[model samples]
Target: MEDIMRGRFSRSMITVAVAAAAVSAVLSVSITRTLGQAPAARPARVGGKPNFSGIWQANNEANWDLQAHAALPAAVTQPGIYPYDYARVPAAPVLALGAAGAVPGSLGVVQGDGQIPYKPEALLIKKQNAEHWIDRDPELKCYLPGIPRAMYMPYPFQITQGTDKIHIAYEFSNTARTIHLDKVAGPPDDTWMGHSVGRWDGDTLVVDVLICATHNLLKLFRFGWSPQRA
Candidate 1:
């Protein structure tokens, strides 16, 4: 690429991040610090098992690894192995930068939604990700939605436990997992969430998983691939 074109693209990224930040600030202020009310505790059933239900949040940075903070990088480039045409990646045209400016890139940028501030190398990898996110994002292809990916999906899921079974329902694609609480005790087979084993210890719910790969189903099924296809 010519020096002039590189400058234009870099500037464009800055502008995009700035504008997104302003709008995000407004949206955050509207939320109350905490829920206004809490439910009263209920007594345990005959078996002394407690019911686990109600709104809960899983707090983790896994969702925003790429958008941890708003900061300019030493360099931002696309990943090498991902599919899709790099030139086709989406980037808004250039504009001004402000402390309140929206961080450039995609998905997580707003005011507080600034750049993900990935480690230097990770940022470069994700920068490559930015280039083809529309097509290459595994979630879009119906893949497993990977760790942290599945956790942060826009939809809500529920977990229900019974004496013999435990059920988890995912909002995306209506994906669900059913665990045999009775311990069928059989040889392992591969599945999306792999096989889950669950038990309760006082107030905590324990989940054990294995043999899972990929967040989207389409990709994990493939054992081999063409070089060009990648």
Candidate 2:
């Protein structure tokens, strides 16, 4: 009886050792395979700067108006009869579209006091442009939206960052601009997209822009002014 008990204990010890060895071998193989593979790639960077290479878009009513406003029945409206006697209606051009031509309300993107600090004279021109928006807005005419306007239009844009230059392409009118990080000659003539010179301010990118003559022309007809910087 003592010999049989000892034999049984020996067999149990051997079985436990074999199972442990099998598990150890499987883990060793897994670890070896993991270490042999290449490391995963990281996001692109230039000189320790963040990569801005991606498609981006703005989802807001900034394109409609930068100032806060209430929802309106239409983009254009005419006078209605005396106090509570009559309701306002859409103007001739957009009347056919009904609610489709209405302007949605926005909280406005302006930073301070929710008002654009327009010069008195410039403010008059702004009012006129608002009144004649349908006829004068450059977007309606499919013109290349310039500068900041291009940045916020309801469309997608792409940014490709490089060692010394960043390229931005806008879906609107296929417009594109290059932001130069290195010193370079300015454009011979003012361009629709303007000349953009850039520098990194810590992690932020500051850009200085000089607009084309066409932008000033548009200001008189459509947009207020060409942005000087972004």
Candidate 3:
């Protein structure tokens, strides 16, 4: 009888140990799940509408291209010491470099002089473009001026919003406006702004420029193509 009592006590102790081990495992899983899944982060919203209220600058070293500037290579894998928030943007060569070939305005921008971030082929193209810009951009050649170029002109521009339509007015020569938003791509007419349509994604304004001037001219691009050394 005593031996039977000892066996029963030992069995009960083993059962308690198993239950405690099971509880510990379950607790660990629950804690891990709770910590790993984070809450979704939402963009800031205002006035039942998304607000895009940042001052955009047109003057930067990237005016020539979107990659890198002189002493700033396209293949650079690390950040530089200078603060280049707006400087990453390409700036026009003539404007960045003064008459004496001095980079007066590009002190914080170009680690070297006013030279831009360009591949060899692109550099050749830019040199040709600089020579002919007063006469022949794709817009003047009757094609869409492309998205980023139009957005980053030296002349100031503005964006106004209505219930369904958004307007972008340029201080450049064309005096053009992009009719888009409200899911509108505009009529099929080719334009410098190229049927730009915009929409709101959270607090950001998403704009799509259709019929970009990759290889063609717009009906509005009536400037004579100068036999000027293309």
**lDDT per residue, candidate 3, 1-230, as tens digits?**
99999999999999999999999999999999999999654334334566432334577634333434343222111233556643332234324333422222323334565355455655555555544553445543444354556665455677655556666676666556655666653556544445666677776677666654434321112122211111
C-alpha lDDT of residue 222 in model 2: 25
lDDT of 2 by residue, 89-199 (tens): 677887887876777889998897997777676677777877887777777678876777788888999998897999998998989999999999988987777888999
Decoy 2 TM-score against native: 0.72
Q: Number of clashing pairs, model 3?
A: 11
Of 2 and 3, the candidate ranking higher by TM-score = 2
Model 3 worst lDDT window (10 residues): 220-229
Tell me the TM-score of each prediction against the true structure. Answer: 0.44, 0.72, 0.43
Each model's lDDT comes to: 0.48, 0.78, 0.50
Positional deviation of residue 188's Cα in model 2 after best superposition, in angstroms: 1.8
Q: Quote the positional error of residue 168 for candidate 2 in Å.
A: 0.9
For model 2, the superposed segments whose C-alpha errors exceed 4 Å read: 1-44, 81-87, 97-100, 214-223, 226-230
* Candidate 1: residue 50 lDDT (0-100): 64
Ranking by TM-score: 2, 1, 3
